[model samples]
Target: MAQDFIAPSILSADFARLGEEVDQVLAAGADIVHFDVMDNHYVPNLTIGPLICEALRKHGVTAPIDVHLMVKPVDRIVPDFAAAGASYITFHPEASEHIDRTLQLIHNEGCKAGLVFNPATPLSHLDYVMDKVDMILLMSVNPGFGGQSFIPSALDKLREARARIDASGREIRLEIDGGVKADNIAEIKAAGADTFVSGSGIFGKGRAEDRNRYDTIIGEMRTALASVGR
Candidate 1:
């Protein structure tokens, strides 16, 4: 089965009502919560960490929390996020000193492990650790900020990555992050991305006072992906 998943990035959600936003999005059919963990050092942006992840759990949001570690010294935070209720944890290969060990650590903590490839990061990172990953996140745009235009080169990269995953014979997910919207989602899926992460593309579309647009935008994306039988 082609499992097309839509993970709404909480980085663009209303911070004051994060729990509500998460509840609503999940209710609206989001597969996962794309939690952005940015350290000021690694990605030139400082965002939330395990504390908020924990809070979300405490708030009764039991959906999978897909934590993206945009931080250096990634190993130390692995245990924290795992303890805080993360279901899937992914970190940039360039940020981790020992890629295999980091993936091992995440698995050891009882979460699905993944490796993130930045817009310019090489696919060679997957050469040794493909066996260790549950998902491969391809950044369609740079990591630091949201709302950037999708980079077209990602289509080729996704196709190449898809071939590698198919050859690996593992059920690893191919996730595309940044600038995903309804219009281009089908093309992205056609390129072999089964999972998606969209920040401004979803949250930025609604009027400031209305968060219910989450359902509308997410449904549109699902419809787009479904139209092609993804």
Candidate 2:
């Protein structure tokens, strides 16, 4: 597997100055702007939604906003984000009652769609939706929060998904979200993930002075990738 740079999570960005924060991230060489959308029913927490995505676009964020929908009945909300200019929308397979319809709906809306599986969700859950997705996000920590510890158990599922994609010979990307930082990045990438999500690890607990912490983490993660010849 090849290594890829971090997709820094923007959930920790200061909402008061979102545009400037996003610009700062881009200046730091972030590959994607990760958005965490949580509906109270599905994830016990409520955060931003499609409206925020629109704001990000309106504020001139050119990097793709990779929207992670931690909401149920994804079909109802996907189109809104699509209209808001999301480049990708990923929903957990467990959240949508009709996974196929949800995946197709996202695709029909013109944004790349992906299926996410929680740490306890098995890889076989993707058997039916594999061909319908552009990417797969395997959560390395429990949803509903940021900066949780990485679950080592999740790595096996990532490898299994990679094997399935390889056996099918499909060009799909494997992504890992939560608990991602410099120390474990290379090992996780070696396990077959090329896309990564980092929230506190990127924005550093919302203090501007601590922004360098995120920068340093990203730099070291890239250095590890380079060392591994990825």
CA lDDT, every model vs. true structure: 0.91, 0.83
Q: Candidate 2: TM-score? A: 0.93
Candidate 1 worst ten-residue window by lDDT? 205-214
TM-score of each: 0.97, 0.93
Off by over 4 Å in 1: none
Weakest 10 consecutive residues, lDDT, candidate 2? 205-214
Q: Report the alpha-carbon TM-score of model 1 versus the true structure.
A: 0.97
Candidate 1 lDDT: 0.91
Clashes of each: 0, 0
Per-residue lDDT for 1-230 in model 1, tens only?
A: 44888998999988988888888889888899999899999988999989999999999988899999999989999999999999999999888889999999999999999999988998998998889999999999999988889999999999999999999999999999988999999999999899999988887866467756578888899889988753
**Model 2 root-mean-square deviation:** 1.8
User: What is the C-alpha lDDT profile of model 2 across 177-215, one tens digit per residue?
Assistant: 989877888888878888888887778733666653345
